[model samples]
Target chain A: MAERTNSKKHYRDNFTGWLLNIPYLAYTAVFFLIPLVWAVWLSTMDWNLMSPDRTFVGIRNFTGMFANPKIIAAFFNSFRYLAPIVVLCFLFGLLLALLISNLPDRIKGVTAVLFFIPYLTSGVATSVVIRFFFSYNSAFNHFLRERFDKDISWFQNPTSAFWIIIAIIVWKMSGYYALFLLSAIESIEPEVNEAAAIDGCVGFRRLVYITLPMILPTITTVIVLASGLAFGIYTEPYLLTGGGPNNATTTWLLEIYNTSFTNFRSGEGAAMAIANAVQIFVTIQLFTFVMNKLNRKFGV
Target chain B: MKRSSKIKTGILIAITAVLLVFSLFPLFYMVIQSLMPWDQVDKSMVLSHPTMKSYQYLLGSGNSSDAFMWVRSLLNSLIVSVPTAVVSVLVGLCVGYSVTKLHFRGKKIIYESLLFQMFFPGVILLVPRYILIKPLANHYLGMILPLCISTWAIFMYINYFTTLPNELFEAAKIDGLGEFGIILKIAMPMTKSVTTIVFLSMFMARWNELMWDMLVAPDIKMQTLNVLISTQFRTMGNFPGPMYAASVLLTLPIIIMFLCASKHFKEGISFMLK
Candidate 1:
C-alpha cells in the first residue's frame, strides 16, 4: 500500500508538470515548429503567396542559386560588411572596456550607460539620419567642400559607401559590445591584476598579457555572436542605401527580400534563403572548430 | 608623475568631448532641420532659424495629404507589439517552467529545438512564413500570431527557470496547488526580473521591427514606425521638411524607451554576449 501510494504521487507530479506545459507546447507547435517545417518543405518547391499549387523541382532550387550573379555578389558583399564591422567593433569595444574598467566605479557606470544609448535606438531611424548625413548636399559633403575643396559622393561610390555602412555599424555596436566586455572584465578577481602590478606589469603590456587571456572566452563568444549577426545585415543597408547604386551595398538578406517581394520570384527567393542558411551553418561550425582549437592551444 | 596624470585627465576629457559631439550631432541635425523654415532649408544654410512649420504640416496643417496616416501607423505598431509581448512571454514562461520541472518524453529534444531556432537567422523565414500566413490575410491575427514565438525569449526564460530551486514547486504541490496554479503563483512571480526583461525586449523588437512588418503588412494602413520612417525617407525629395519632422517624431518613443530601460538594456546585451 505504501509503495503504491508513492508511485501514485510521482505519477501525479509528472502529470501536473505535463499539464502546465500544454499552453507553451501548443504555441511552439503552432508558431515555431510548424513554421520551421513549412520553411523546409517550401524550400524544395515554387509557391507564390496567393497560389494554391506548389511545384516541386527536387534539389534544383538549391543548385540553381549558384547560377545567379547577384546572389554571388550579395554573398561576397555580406562578408565585406561583416569583416570590418566585426573586427573594428571587437577591437574598439575591448579598448573602451579596458579604459572604463580602470576608472572609478561611479564614473564607469555612468559612462557605460551613456555609450550604450545608441545601441538601443532603432536601427531604422538611425539609418535614416545617417542617410541624410551622407546625402550629396548634406553636411558631410559640405564640410568636405569647405575644408578640402572637393565633393565626395558617398552613396554613389561603392568603396566609400561601403565604409559608411561600416562606420554606422561600428558606431551602433561598439558601446553595446563594450558593456559586455566590461562585465566580463569586472568579474575578474582583483588579486591577479594586483600581482601583475607588483611585478611591474602596468599599462598596455599588463592588459595584453594578463587581462586578455583571462577574458578570452567572452571574446570568443562576442566574435561568434557578431559573425552570426553579420549574415543578417538587412536593416542598415536597406534603410541607408536600399541596396542601390548598382547593388553595391546589397547583402544576402536584402537580395532575398528583393527576390521574394520585389521580383515575386518565390522559388528563387526560397533557394536564396536555403543557400544563405547553409552558408551560415557552415560558417558557425567552422568558427566553433577554430575557436575550440585556439582555446585548447592557449589553454584558456 | 602628477603632471602626467593631469595630462591623462586632459586627454580623457578631450576624448569625451569629441565622442559626445559625434554622438549628438546627427540627432541635433535632424531636429534642427525639422524646425527650419522650408525655404531656408533648401538654401543650404547651417543653423537656419527655427519654425514650427514642419510640425504643423505633419499634424495636418494646410495642404497636408492623409497626414493622419502617421497616427494609424502608430496604432498599428502598438497593436502588434502589445499582443506579441503578452503572448510571447506567457508562452515562454509556460514552456520554460515545463521544460525545467516536467519529466516527459522528448523533453530534451523540444528544448534543443527551441535553442536551435535562436541561432537561425530570422530573415530565412521571410518567404516561408509569408506563405504560411498568407491564408489568413488582412487580419490583425495574421500579423501578430506568426511573429509571437521568439526562440530567444523562450531560451531566456528556460535559463532563468532552471536556476530556480525545485523545492519551491514541491512545497506548492504539498499545499494542494495544481501545476498551473504553481506556475501562475509561484514560478511567474519568482521570475519577475527575467519576465520584465523578456517583455521589454519583445516589445522593443516588435515596435521597431521592419523586415517582417514590411513582408507581412505592405499596406500603408498597417505599417509600423520603422516602415513609416522608411517610406518617408524614400520619398524625402518630395517632402523634405515633413520627412525630417516625421523622423524625429518616430524616433522620440524609442529614445524615451531607451533612456528608461538603459540599465536593463545593458544587462540584456551582456547576457547575449555571454
Candidate 2:
C-alpha cells in the first residue's frame, strides 16, 4: 500500500510538471517539429505556392543541387567568409578586450557600452548608411577620384564587394566578441598575475605565456561562435550585392532565399537547405574537435 | 617604474581614442548626413546647411513617392516585437521553472532538444515554414508566431533558476504555498534580473529581424521598418537623406535601450560566455 501510494504521488508530480511545460511543448510541436518534418517531406516533392498539385521528384532535387553552379558557389563562399571572420574578429576582439581591461573601472564601463553600439545597430540600417557612403556622387567617391584619380564603383566590382561585406561584419561583430573575451580576461585570478609578475613575467611575455593560456577556452568558444555565424550571412550580401558580379558573394542563405522564395523551386531549395544544415553540423563538429585538440595541447 | 606605468596607461588611452574614432565615425556620418538637404548630403564632412527634410520626409510630410510607409512600419515593428518578447519570456519562464523545480519524465529530453535547436541552422526550415505560414500571410499571427519562443531565453531562465537554493522552495511548500504560488511569488521575484535580460534580448532580436518579417508579411500595410528600409533603399539611391534618416530611426530605440540598461545588456552578453 505504501509503495503504491508513493508511485501515485510520483505520477501526480510528473503530470504537474508536464502541465506546466504544455505551452512550450505545444508551441514547439506546431512551429518547430511540424515544419521540420514537412521540410524533409517537401525535399522529395516539386511544389510551389501557386500550384495546387505537387509532383514527387524523389532525390532529383538533392542530386541536381550538387551540380548547380550557384549551389557550388554558395558552398565555397561560406568558407571564404568563415576563415577571415574568425581570424579578424579574434584579433580585433583580443586587442579591444586587452585595452579596455587595462583602463580604470569607470571609463571601462563607459567604453564597453560605446563599443557595443555597432552590434546593436540593425544590419539593414548599417547597410543603408554604408550604401549612401559608397554611392557614386558621394564625398567618399569624389575624394577617391580627385586625390588618387580613381573612381571605383564599390559594389559593382566583385573583389571590393566581397571585402566590403567582410569589413562591415568585422566592424559589427568584433566589439560584441570583445565583451566575451573581456569577461574572461577579467575573471583571471589576481594571484596568478602576481605570481607571474614575481617571476619576472610582464608585458608581451606575460600576455603570450600566461594570459593567452588562461583564456584559451573562451578563445575557443569565441572562434566556434564566430565560425557558426558565417553560415548565417544573409543580410549584407542580400541588400548590397544581390550575390552579383559573377556570383562572387553568393551565400547559402542567399541562394536558399532566391531559389525557394524568388524562383518558387521549393523542392530544390529544401534540398539545398538540408545540405546547408548538415554542413553546419559537420563544420561545427570539426571546429570543436580542432579547438579541443589545441586546448589540450596548450595545457589548458 | 611609476613613470613607465603612467606611460603605459597613456598609450592605452591613446590607442582606445583612435579606435573609437573608427568605431563611431560611421554613426556620426549617418547623423550628420541625415541632417543635410538632399542635394547637400554626402557632399561635405561638415553640415553647413542642416535641415529636417529627411526626418520630415520619413514622417510623410515630403513628396508622396519619398514618403512610402516608414512610420507605419515602425508601428508594425512595435506591434510584433513587444508581444514576441512578452510571450517568449512567459513561456521560457514557465518551462524553465518547471524543468528546474519539478520532477518530470521527459525533462532531460526537453533540455536536450532545446540544445539541439540552439545549434540547429534556422535557414533549413524556411521553405516549410513559409508553406505553413502562407495561409496566414499578412496577418500578425504569421509574423509573431514563429519568433515567440527562443532556445536562448529558455536556457537563460533555466541557468538562473538553477542557482537559487532549493530550500527556499521547500520552505514555501512547508508554509502551504502551492507550486504555482511559490513560482509566482518567490521564484518570479528572485528572477527579475534574468527576466529583464531575456526580455530585452528577445525584443531586440525580433525588432532587428528582417528576412522572416519580410517573408511572412508581403503586404505593404503590415511590413516592419527593416523590410520597408530594405525595399526602399534599392530605389532611394539619388535621394540619400531619407535613407539615412530612416536608418537612424530604425536604430534609435535600440541605442536608447542600450544606454538605459547597459548593465543588464552587458550581463546578457556575459551569459553567453558561460
Candidate 3:
C-alpha cells in the first residue's frame, strides 16, 4: 500500500511540474525564440515586403549598412539625443527627489503622483500636444513673438527642433525618473541621515557626499534604463516631425522602419536591426562592467 | 543667522514653482486648446474665447462619424489591453512561481535571459516580428500576442515572487497538494498586490501601444486609440482645436485608470527596485 501510494505521488509530481511550465515554454518559444531566429534568417536575405523572392545574400546587407554615411549619421544623432536626456533627467530627478524626500509624507505622495502623470499618458498624445505648442502660430511661438519679436520656426529649423526634442525628452523623463529616485531615497534609513546631521554633514554637502553615494546602485540602474530608452525614441520624433526638416530628427529605429516598410528593403532593415541590437548589447554590457567596478571602488 | 536658511527655502520654492509650470504647461495648453471655439482660433490670436463646441463635436449627438470612430477605437483599445493584461500577468505569475519555488535545472539561465530581455530595447525585434506575424495571424491577435508576453512583466513577477516566503509552498507540499495546486491555491493568493501591479503596468503599456498597432493593423477599422489619435493628427493638418479635443478625449480613460492605479504603481516600482 505504501509503495503504490509513493509511485502515484511521484507520477503526480512529475505531471504537475510539466503542466506548470507548459504555458511559459510555449509562450517563449513561439513569441521570443521563433521571432529571434526568424530575424536572423531574414537578415541574411534580400527580402522585400512586396517581393515573394528572398535570395540569400550572406553578410552583404551588414557591410552595406556599415558603408552608408546616412546610417552612421543616424547613429551619431541617436547619441546626441541620448546623452543630454540621460544626464539631464538623472540630475534633475535626483534634485527633485531630494526636495520631495524632505517634505511631509502626504505632500511627497501627492507630488510623486503629480509627476508620474506625464509618464502614464500616451507618448503620442504628449508628442501631439508638443507638436502644436511648437507650431508657428501656436501659443509658444506666440509668446515668443509677443515678448521678444522672435518668431522661430521650431520644427522647420533643425537646431531649434533638436533642442525642442531634447527639452521634451528631459521634461517627460525627469518626473518618472524622480519617482524611482524618491523610492530609493525613502528606503535609506532615517537614522543614517540623522547620523550624518550629527556629524556636521547638513544641507547640500550631506546630499552630495552621503545620499548620492548611498543610492549609487539605483542610479546605475536608472542610467542604464535611460540609455536603453534613448535607442527606441521613435514615436515622439515620428509623430512630432515625422523624422522631418529633411530627416534631421531621424533616429536609428526610425531609420530601420523607413528602410523596411517605407522603402521596401526588409533585408537591410533586418541587418540594421541586428546592428542596433549588437550596439545596445555591447553598450549595456560595458555599462554593467563599469558599474560593477565602481561598486567595488565605492564598496557598495 | 537664520536669514540664509529662509533665503534658501525661498529659492527652493521658486525653483519648484518653475518646474511645476514647465511640467504642467503643455497639459494646460492642451486643455485650453480643447476648450477654445474653433472659429476664434487664428494666426493673430493665441488664446480665444472658451467654448464647448469642440467637446460637443466629440460627444454630442448628430456628430456620429467622429464620435463613432472614437468610440470604436476606444473599444478596440479595451479589447487589446484587458486581455493583454490578464494573460501577461497570469503567464508571468506561472513563470515567476517556477523560477522562485521550483528546483529546476537551468532556471538561473532562464531568469538571467529574461532580465536581459527586459532591459533590451524592443525596437530591434519590431521588424522581424512584423514580418513573421504578417503571414501567420495577420490581425489584432497577432499584435496582442507578441506584446502580451513582455519581458518587463516577467521580470517584475520574478522579482515580486522571490520576495514571497517559501514556507507557504513547503507547507502546501507537506499537505499533499500538488505543485500546480500550491501555486493556484497558495502562491497566487499571497501575492495579490504584486499581481495587481503587474496587471496595471501591462494594461497601461497595451493601452498606449501605437507602433505595433500601426505596423500590424493598417486598417482604420482595426486601429487602437493611440493609432486613431495619430491618424487624426496626420489628417487634420493644422487644426489645433479639434486635434487637442481629440487628444483630450482619448487621454481621459488612461488618466482615470492612472488615478486608480497610482498607489499600485508606487508599490510595484518599490518592490521591483528592492
Candidate 4:
C-alpha cells in the first residue's frame, strides 16, 4: 500500500503543473491563437462574410488594399492623426508632468484624477460634447465671430475638422500620458537636478537640455501608446464625423469597417486589417530600435 | 536665486491651473449642458435658466423610448463587463500562480510568449478577433470572450505571485493542502494588491469597450452604454442637451468608482508598471 501510494504521489506531482495550466492554455489557444490564424485565413479568401464565393485569392486582397482609394486615404490620415498628436501630446504631457511634480504630494492624487477624468471617460461621449462645442452654430464660434469677426465652420472645413480631432485627442489623452511621465520625472534623483543647477541649467533651458533626455524611455513608451491610440481611434471619428467632409476623417479602421460591414467586403476588410497590423508592427519596432540607440547615445 | 525660484514656482502653478481647466473643461461642459434648460442652451451657453429637462428626457419620463435604449445598454454593459472582469482575473490568478509556483514543462516558453504578446498592440487583434467571433454577434458572450484574456495581466499576476513568501507554500505542502489549495488559500489572499489591480483595469477596459462591442453587439437592444452613447451622438445630433445628459450618465459611474477605489488603484497600477 505504501509503495502504491508513493508511485501515485509521483504521478500527481508531475502532472500538477499541467493540470493547473489547463485553463490558460485552453482559453489562449481557442480565443487568441485560433482567432489570429482565422483572421489571416479569412483575409486570403474572397467571401463577402457569408455564403457562395468562398474562393481563396492568395495575396490579391492584400495588394488590393493599397489599390483601394479609401484605404489609401485612410493610410495617410492615420499619419496625420499620429504625427501631430504624438508630438503635441509629448510636449503637453511633459509640461503637465513637470507642473504636477511641483505640487505637494498630498494633493497630487486628486489633481491627477481630475486631469485623468477625460482619459477615463468614454472617447465617444467626449467627442460628442466636443462636436457640440465646435459646432458652427454654437456659442463658441458665435462668440468667436462676435469678438474677432471670424466664424470658421469647423466640421465643414477639412483642416479645422482634422485639428478638432487632434484637439480632442490631446485634451483627453495628454493628462493620462502625463501620469506615466510624472512617475519617470519623480524617479530622477534630486542630486542630478542640483548638479545641473550648479552647471547653469535653469527653467526652459534646463528642461530642454537636462530633463528631456532623462525621460526618453518613458517618452518612448508614451510615443508607442499615443501612436497605438491614433490607430485605434474609431469611436471619436465614427461617432463625431462618420468619416465625413468628403471622407477627410475616414481612418484605416473606419475604412475597414465600412468595407466589411457596409460594403460587404469582409475579405478585403480582413486584408486591410492585416496590412494595418504590419504597419503598426514595423513602426513600433522602428521606434523601439531608434529609442534604444538614443538611450545608449544619451548615456541613460 | 530666491526671487528667480519664486517666479518659477508661480509659473508652474499658473501652468498647472491652465492645463487643469483645459483637461477638465469637456466634463464640466457636459454636466452644464445636461442640466441647462433647452431655452438657455443657446449660442452663448450662459447658464441663465438651468433645469433637469435633459435628464428627464434621458430617464424617458418623456415617453419617447429614449430611456429604454440607455437603460438597456447600461444593463448590457453590466452583463458583459462584470463577466469579463471576473473571468480575466480568475484566469490571470490561476495562470500566474501555476507558472510561478509549479514546476511545469514549457514553463519558460509560456512566460516568454506572454511577454512577447504584451509588446504587440491589442488592437491589431481586433479585426481578426471580430471576424472569428462575428457569427455569435449580438450575444453577450460573443463580446465578452474576445476581451476575456490579457497576457499582460497574466504576467502581472505572475510577477506578484513570485514575490510571495515561499514559506507559505512549503507549510501548505507539509500540511498536504495541495497546489490548488495553496494558491487559493495563501497566494491569492496575500496578493490582494495585484487582484485589485487586475480586477479594476480589466473592469475599466471592459466597461469602456467600444470597438468589439460595436462589431459584435450592433443590434440596438444589445449595444453597450458606450456604443449607445456613440450612436446617440450620431443619430440624435440635434438633441445636444439630452445627448450630453447621456454622456454624463455614462461617465459618472467611472468617476465615482475611481474616487472611491483610487487609493487602491494608484498603488496597484504603479506596481503593475514596475
lDDT of 1 by residue, A198-236 (tens): 999988888877888788788888788788877878888
Task: Report chain B TM per candidate.
Answer: 0.85, 0.94, 0.84, 0.89
**lDDT per residue (tens digit) for residues B19-121 in model 4:** 7887787788888888887755635556777889988876777747545767778788889888888888888887888777765567787787788777765
Task: Compute the lDDT of residue A110 as modeled in candidate 3.
Answer: 76
Task: State the local distance difference test value for candidate 1.
Answer: 0.76
Clashing pairs in 3: none
Candidate models: Cα lDDT each: 0.76, 0.88, 0.77, 0.79
Candidate 3 regions with alpha-carbon error over 4 angstroms: A1-13, B1-14, B41-49, B59-67, B119-121, B136-138, B175-181, B264-266
lDDT of 3 at B241: 69
Best by DockQ: 2
* Model 4, span A189-274: residue lDDT tens: 99999998998897788787777888888988898888888887777778777777877888988888888877877778778888
Per-model TM-score versus the true fold: 0.91, 0.96, 0.91, 0.92
Candidate order (TM-score) = 2, 4, 3, 1
Ranking by DockQ: 2, 4, 1, 3
Which pairs clash inside model 1?
A: none
Task: State how far residue A78 of model 2 sits from its true place (Å).
Answer: 0.4
Tens digit of per-residue lDDT, candidate 2, span A1-300:
454667655445687788888888888888889989998999998988579998999999999987899999999999999999999999999999999999977799788878878888889988988887898888999999999999899999999999999999999999989988999999999999999999999989989998898899999989998998888999999999999878998899999999999999999899899999999889999999988998898844
Per-candidate DockQ values are 0.49, 0.74, 0.48, 0.56
